[model samples]
Target: MKADFLKYQAQTTPHPLAMEVSYAKGSYIYDINCKKYLDFVAGVSACSLGHQHPKVVNAIKNQLDKYLHVMVYGEYAQKPAVELSKLLASHLPAPLDTTYLTNSGTEAIDGAIKLAKRVTGRSEIIAANKAYHGNTIGALSIMGFEERKQAFRPLMPDVRFIEFNHELDINQITTKTAGVVLETIQGGAGFIEPQDNYLKKVKERCDNVGALLILDEIQPGIGRTGKLFGFENYNCVPHVVVTGKGLGGGMPIGAFTASYEHMITLSDEPKLGHITTFGGHPVIAAAALATLKEITESNLIQETLEKEQLIRKHLKHPLITEIRGKGLMLAAMTPSADITNQIVLQGQEAGLILFWLLYEPKAVRITPPLTISNEEILEGCDILMSVLNKIQPTN
Candidate 1:
């Protein structure tokens, strides 16, 4: 299987963590050799309820028995999709009642950009530096990192970037701007949270210029961040909220929500302006609905903050320079990129799962499942501390 994976499958990076998984359960994955490894990354924050959650699995099974993809999104009113969207609307603030489901977070980002332009009739989109929306052409266009996107040049035009959390940069979001796309908490950029009312001020600027504010909550949404959404923690309500990642539990799904007035524009003028073949696939939607219900009904959302405190309290070490981010969405920074790499690589050998941020080499991502218990959090942190201690600098 490993040999076939290397030969048949296309590789994203030169070095990929090729762990042959036999099965996974709550907070743990077992390799083909039957070695149990503690999962701290939670499939990069996609497995909200951990692996093979009962509710999500049962929802998928029930939906499969009923139906699958009956039609393209927004064509047929599927129960799972309808209930999911309605539940999302109930939780979200005003003017964010309508949702358009997509296959992945990147698609939702693209859709949100289109909606912003359509609603405001403006072309320019202002994004924050070090922001990562997704990998699609439209999403790549708004990406702030140049090194990764330079090869995919000549992307969508009228996209500009500004330094995140920079007060002066708010001036750039003028009347000509259709929208300002930002990660509620910058994921790839070391989980940088908006500080000093930065997001609120940016929303205010967008309001002043009549430009829409689109918050990408792909990584920080779905109760991973104490609040249901990261923007809620900062008291910044965006014009459009883009969600994905843990929205579907262990399944795949994405969505963008806005006011009925703004979302309805996607229809009529273009009549299926943005169409998806399986955006709201019944099985995936069922899983998402189940995940949403579990998160909202259970104490998982509130416990995230308590779990985060436990992680911080146990993870204190000389090698760990600082911990960034809130709730379960966290990044443990090391003194050097070399140390970060060592910890992640050696962590797998130590029977614990760890990952790195996309752009921040010095930061080790620790975005575990929100349902991870205090004992699990301490266990993972102990493994991390052990790894860091063994690899401590001799200088």
Candidate 2:
């Protein structure tokens, strides 16, 4: 099977951590050998309610019995899509009422960029340094790093770059700019949060320049950061918000939301300006709706902070320099890429699932499920501590 996987699969990286899975429940995943591994990365922050959550699974099963993709996104009055959009609007601040659903976060990002251009009638989109929105051409155009995107040459034009949390860099945004795309907490840049009202200042600058602020909450949203949206914690409401990842509860989905007045413009002048066949697929929508309801209704949201504290308490080591980010969206920084790599590889052997961030080589990704128990948190931490100790035998 491993040989077949390597030969058949077109992998993104040269070496992929191909874990042959049997099934997963709650916070643990089992391999074909029946070895259970405690999940810490939460499927790269996608499985919010953990793997095969009862509600999400039931939602999918129920929707399957009813219907699949009946029509295109906006034409059909689908229950799951409509309910999900309405619920999202209810949670978000005013003017961000309407939503356009897509298959993935990257598509949603491109949608947001189009919406920004439509609303403002401008061409320039500004993004921060070391930012990772998505891999689509439009999203990639605004990506901060050059190494990953250079191969996909001639991306969307007129995209600019700014330093994350650098107040002086805010000057780059001007009246000519259509939108300023930012990760609420810069994920690939080692989970760096906006410091000293950095996001607020950016919003203010955008407001003054008549440019839209598009917050990519794909990673930090969905109750992972103790808020439905990470921007809520920082007291800045964006003109547009893009979300995915944990929203699907192990399913695949993405959405870009803005005001009805702004979103309506896409339908007339160009008439069917942006359309997707499977964007709001009812089965996936059902899963997303269920996931959102469970997140908002449960005590899981508040418990993120407590769980974060527990992780911070137990996972300390001399080799570990700093833990960046809030709630469960954390990055434990080691001294070098070699140490970080060793920890991730050894962690799997020790019955714990760990991973790494994209651009940041020295940081180990540790985004666990919101439903992960306190005991599980401690258990994972102990496994991690043991791994770190072995790596630091001299100390």
Off by over 4 Å in 1: 392-395
- Model 1 weakest lDDT span, ten residues long: 386-395
Candidate 1 accuracy as lDDT: 0.93
lDDT of 1 by residue, 9-56 (tens): 999998889999999999999999999999999999999999999999
Per-residue lDDT of 191-287 in model 2, one digit per residue for the tens?
A: 9999899899999999999999999999999999999899999989999999999999998999999989999988978998888999989999999
Quote each prediction's TM-score: 0.99, 0.99
- Cα lDDT for residue 105, model 1? 97
lDDT of each: 0.93, 0.94
**lDDT over C-alpha atoms for residue 23 of model 2:** 91
**Once model 2 is optimally superposed onto the true structure by TM-score, how far is the C-alpha of residue 301 displaced, in angstroms?**
0.6
> Which regions in candidate 2 have their CA more than 4 angstroms from the true location?
392-395
